[model samples]
Target chain A: MSLESVVAQSHVIVCCGSGGVGKTTTAAVIALHAALQGRKTVVVTIDPARRLADALGLDGLTNEPAQIPGLPEGSGEMWAMMLDTKATFDGLVRRYAADSNQTEQILENSFYRNISTSLSGTQEYMASEKLYELAIESDYDLVVVDTPPTRNALDFLEAPRRLAKFLDHRIYKVLMLPTRGIVKAVNVAAQTLLRSISKVVGTEVIADAIAFFGAFEGMEQGFKERAAEVDSLLSQPDTAFILIASPHADTMAEAQFFAARLRELKITVRALIINRMQPSFGDNHSPEDLAERYAGTPLGEQYQCLAEAQHLARGEQKHLLGLAQELAPAPVVQVPVQAFEVSNMATLQMLGQAMFDTDVTSEP
Target chain B: MDPKQFLTTSGVIIVAGKGGVGKTAVSAALAMASSSVGLRTLIVEVEGKSGLASLFNSAQFSYSEIQLVEPSLGVGEVRARTVLPEDALLDYLKDHGLKRISGRLVSTGALDVVATAVPGISDILVLGKIKQLERSREFDLIIVDAPAAGHAITFLRSASGLEDAVKVGPINSQAKDVLALLNDPTRCRVLLVTSPEETPVNELIETAYSLEDEVGVSLGPVVVNGVLPELPGLQANPLEAAAQAGVELQPSEAQNLADAALFRLQRTALQRAQLDRMAQELPLPQLLLPYVFTSELGPDGLAQLSNGLLAKIRDLPDPSRS
Candidate 1:
């Protein structure tokens, strides 16, 4: 099946690859294509560059879904949002807190303030949370996500499970105990752990962490349960992981690694979109053919540059061909290295058309 | 600036940029440029994914340094190793004489807790290690291939963020020292790399502003990587050129070459426009790295880039001893 078919069937499209692989633009392009096909779509991006917003014809994106302007009038609609990790974490806090006071207690805690915004997996967890929210609550037929630019591919995939485990941690349970109730005999294992951490990070930081977990007592269950939901939703059959990769060896290795990781999670890459591939032009006459055809022409002088260019293209394809074969059954869509990037609606739409019009096939 | 001037004056040059912008490759090339001039260089890889070891075909370097690219004729040397947060924290504990606690921190899974519960601990640990390296005066130049742009901001600001969070303790004092190293222009400078594209240039500008305003780190010349090389006579008709050279081309051959030429011309124009915008927007001296037209930037491609870097650095004005 082509990417168009994947877009038609999948409810959640997770665009993931290494950073600077044009993951955001590819996500936006897929979402736009979905919308044009009369499927109401929402694209949730994490910290989009200004040009992505410009391509979507918006001043900028926000935490809340803002309808994208200037799409061709159609039955389907398009909305875009940039995930604010802290805001999403705060919303989760508010949703789970027993009352306003408890909410304030948890939110005001210094440790919560630090981890909600700066904790390694906070963005990934919140992005997944937002995706679940849009998938179930919103009326959109499809929800496409632009994962955070995390170098570790495992971070986005592991965030929900990691959070759930954190909520269920023995250290967390030990920290949740009242400050006055920490007797010597109580939680000897956890006490020893805390003593070790305190020596290195200082006891004041531990006290803050204890207070942080103390305030988060009643809300842990909600968070753990929600994280569980996200973990399952991610592996659902209707969810597609569209991997966007460039032709370089590094990014190709990254994409291959990503695909292998997804396989471990039982999620196959729905479509492998190889972006910015230099076409070999071997589809036309070979340089040998050209040389033979025009032995005495001025074009013979130009063979060096053209042949060099062709060699470069062949090198790119060599890497991509391996990626395509490994990610079998996923439609391999090759978007040629364009003369221009997607800057405006016209070009964006042009890209959307080009995505499907190009070679969208799968040998597997 | 001469290659010597550029290599010797800089203490720790942190090469950072958005992912896929050839930041790692730039870091490797910078190390090559230094070692070529008989400068002992150490390239510190953070997060452990920069592919630094692969460029040299060396084995994966751990927390400790290993000889990566051996010098030719005893003139140059490049050693590389990784500095991760967890490993740095472990070393940090040992350095502070908490060797006993270090073992428990790992066995009890408290390392993750300490790193996560206390904000900026992870980053500070890594920076503190870098600070230690600088203090050792081990290398003529220390090139830290820092994280991509978004995390690069947090990474640089982590010391200040820690100082704000913890007013007293070893962590706070450690942050103070790291901040000292970061703020001192002579000690450390951030060399930002970016492609000649809209998004990368945009991210680099914002990261530069944050590094200056929030982190107070000195900025070096912005490296415009992947700049398209211009070719003469790109606009001329391929058929006419072919005819002029006393050879004729089939229509299809002419068409294929024409299409490739047009794409090249347009890419050059677009790159030139973006490069101009960058000069006006970010008022910093820029060193342009030509786009290597190879498939993979292996040792050969990196050699070319390394040579180009030295040539560009020489054209720059010598740094004043501030």
Candidate 2:
């Protein structure tokens, strides 16, 4: 199916790509198109561009989706939300906690307070958790996700599994026992492990950790089950993944890697959207010929400009051909580099038109 | 300080930026520029996937330092190595002569525990290794290719955060030493990298302020990579300009030429506007590297970029004067 169909029909669309490749912009454009097609849509971004936030009329930090003002006429409705990782983590704690006291225990624990934000997997995992919350709990027709900008974008997919692994680790189990005051189960090896860790990080860290784990008790099953549900939700027919990329070799490489990884995970990339591609000059003539034809004149310099621009465009096309070959049969949409930054709603609409090869933006 | 002093002023120059902004490439250029001035430079790569080794025409760097550029007449050497928390922890254990515990630590997966249980332990481990390298003075300059901007803030601040979190232990002392090195301008400084684009420029301003107000890391010149070069005769119409130049162009040719000309002109204008805003919002010396349009993005491209960076570095005003 076409990318427009993905926007029209899918319940969830995940935009995965590296940073500085306009991944967030692509997500926004897609969401805008979905709204223009009269489908209720919400685009969630980890860090919203200041201008985008302004255009959305978002005054400050918002925990829920806010309706986008002044969408092109006939657009169903568009909403934007800024993902607050900390607030989402706290929500999980409240959801899984057996009682509010358990919830307070986890929230008030200094170690949890410190690691909940800085935790290696927490940021990525929290993004998925938020996605699950919006997809399963919200009423929007489509949920567009701009995945967090991690060096390895696959971290978002593997994060739940990694956290689950940590939860089930024997060492983690050992740490939990001490908080429960199970002296009988603390083997000599476990004792040595605790002492060794304390020698390196001091006893207070160990104490804080035990307390945090104790507070986390009875919450693991709920988290594990939710993770399983999210995992299933991702691979379901209702969900779609679009891989965003650029002409730069580094980004192209990242895109290829992401596609391959998704394949390993049994997820198919619906479409490949390459943003910021140089507009082709369509000059088939060689630079040698152009120079001879327009030598020693102002026109020669102008022709040189054309030649240089064409050279870059040709090179990018070559690189993208390899990407296309690697990702064979996946429809590739090439969007020219924007003349201005996509900081406003007008430019965003123009980009959406360019992606779909349509001119519905004529009214503006 | 002059360019040489601007570079040698601090033993450690941590290069960081948003991913896909050529953070790793900037790190390579800085190393090449430093070595050009007869300074022995070593680059510490934290992201094993950084492809920094390839920039120097070498294989992937492991824990063992690989000499990428050998010393020559009037030029120093360039060497690099990758530092993971696992390797650094093993080295730390071996340094203290606890070799047996080291093997068991890995075998029992206690290292992962240490990293998870102690927030920022991995970053501190990596930074601690850089500290050790700085103390040895084996290299006149050390450039760390730090993580991307988002993680970079947390990475650089890890030591200080841990210092406050853990008050008395080996981890605490390590945190203190790393924080000291970061805070001392003469010992280390951070160089924020960015492209002349809106989102990156905005992020750079925020990152620069965060590093100063939060991490207390000394800031150096902002290396603005990927600046588009000014196209000649941008204002003149291609058809009109050709007619004036005593040359006639076909309609299609003129169209293609105008398309390219407009593209280049708009890009250069945007570059200027973004740089102007950056100057107003964040007043740091800017080192402009032209946007690369090369088909060959290997050693040759890296050399060209390095030369441009070195030229810009030489033009920076003396910090003491500021």
Candidate 3:
């Protein structure tokens, strides 16, 4: 159940959680740890925060995987990339189009230009597409994906099926057939109907739609096949999901909800990572006794603060315990709140080591 | 204007921040503060997280507004509700005499397609619902716990995006109205919330700039939540203090106290640096909320936060208006 073993065993590791819970940092640290252990690793991040680049000591990240420098000589290669949804979609169009002319037509279509990038779940879909592409085409031993914050994380998991459904849906095909000569026999009636629709939806908008779908006509099959491949890859035994969260009540609730949804999707959650845990005081003198012993002294105020900190720590422990009971049989790892943010390789290395040392499973 | 006056005058106040930055807690606190001052308040959550209900110690909230905290001083009442885009779409269709077809649309997945194909359509729907409620004048204030910072800018700009896409239509016209309401400083304001941390602070600054430059929304004060209190007269090292005081302690106890003090001092220093950055970079009013040590931030905790917020507001320069 150790993180090292998990990284060694799973080809695909998906880091998911609610927002602002250190998911990006966790994913980067895990990727670094895997690489340091001599596994070629690439961390793909969909986080808009740009923290991954900072953690990896890169000036910036792009859609292409850039190998990070300054690792130990014997360590495996580490690469990082940020998911650019628009670029990924454009790449897909370029790859699947019948010809460069068709690609030009599709790219120039207003509806395609807008929807390809700004669609609600388009980022999730593109992330899945990129991950699938990397898994099949790249030489990396492990691919770690940091997904978008909660709720959207589910969208990431469901993106392939959703895209496939959209492509195969009958209405879209019907709308495009008028432009593809497939309905030439009934062209007159369809033209009249389209005219009325265009009048309502604006003629230019309808034209753009028709052109976009027309350009996509022959590519639907390829899109669906790729979507299915991504779907299968995600559900395979070699892929694992990690649910990350802090011990805050809302975060823990969200993590649990996501875990349940992942279970419903038949995706096994390999581990639960609770980050920013309160620093434990261990079995030292109780805060209450310390408070009494130091009462009326100048240090009493300090004792009070210590007592409050301990109380908060205990509260966090309670929540962590509750989460453990709720997610029984899933190994839990607790990471204490660091005094400084994990911004560079040195801090990330320390964090990775801390994470490695804290992989204790709850009693079943 | 002071925070209280800003809250009273603006019809819609959006509480936005990075996720897990206590936006919900701040929104609830603001609503309670408004309600206590006798302004009819409605706190709305659009993320479908039902966080407001939990903050209020309730089980769940439907799309319809329900009374959450009764108003004091006979001003008005406080209510809470959850709004989802799907529900808004159904409501919109029902209002347009397509009630029967709405269910069909949902069942056949046509609604999902429409929501997806049109960028920001869901956001427009949610904002459209809020606009409708604001026009109804049922509440004096509507506090929205908007999406996290990155998506929030998109959510706020949905109206303009729709307006640009559909130049002329009922939807476009509605977007125009929403845009006008959002741009009017007297009608709408955005309060950026951030925990005293590097990531959240950085996000707050970026989001604040975008809110102004992209959406044309007026920015209000920034609420810095979970700030650590400075323990006055404490030395840099507590162990050194204890040694100077000639106090005897076991190794474990000494180590525990020293660790605790060091952690607090480090956090306090970090918080100060972050706050200074906010003040230097943003140039907006800032309010600090101390870190609450409670295990659960239930209704009582929210009330305490509300009082703290009110105290901070009172300390600001009073508004010139009546």
Give the CA lDDT, 0 to 100, for residue B104 in model 3. Answer: 57
Candidate 3 TM-score over all chains jointly: 0.92
DockQ ranking, high to low:
2, 1, 3
lDDT of candidate 1 over A67-162, digit per residue (tens): 888777764889999998888889999999899999998788877777776667888998999999999887889999999887777688899878
How far off is model 1, as Cα RMSD?
2.9
Q: lDDT tens digits, residues B1-322, model 2?
A: 3557778989999999987678888999899888888899999988767668767778779998989889998688999998976788667755654565777777766666666667888888899999999999999999999988888998998998889878886888899999999999999999999999888898899999999999999998899988887756656787898888777778887888778788788888898999999999998989999777753368878988999998887787766777
For candidate 2, the docking band is medium
lDDT of 3 by residue, B1-322 (tens): 3555757768999999988888989998898888877788898888876477889877677887788776656556888888887887667656655554556557656555455556676788788889888999888899998987788998999898889988886668778988988999888899999999988999899999988999999988899988877875244355665665567667777677777777878888888999998899999989888788765687777888888888888776666853
Candidate 1, residue B196: CA error in Å? 1.1
In lDDT terms, which candidate is top? Answer: 1
Q: Which residue window of length 10 is worst by lDDT in model 1 chain A?
A: A296-305
Q: Which residue pairs clash in candidate 2?
A: none
lDDT (Cα) of model 2: 0.81
TM-score for model 2?
A: 0.93
For residues A80-158, could you state the per-residue lDDT of candidate 3 as single tens digits?
9999888999999899988999999988877786676565677888888999888889888999998877555698877
The positional error of residue A81 in candidate 3, measured at the CA in angstroms, is 0.5
Q: Which stretches of candidate 3 lie over 4 Å from their true place?
A: A174-203, A283-297, A360-364, B1-4, B71-75, B93-97, B233-248
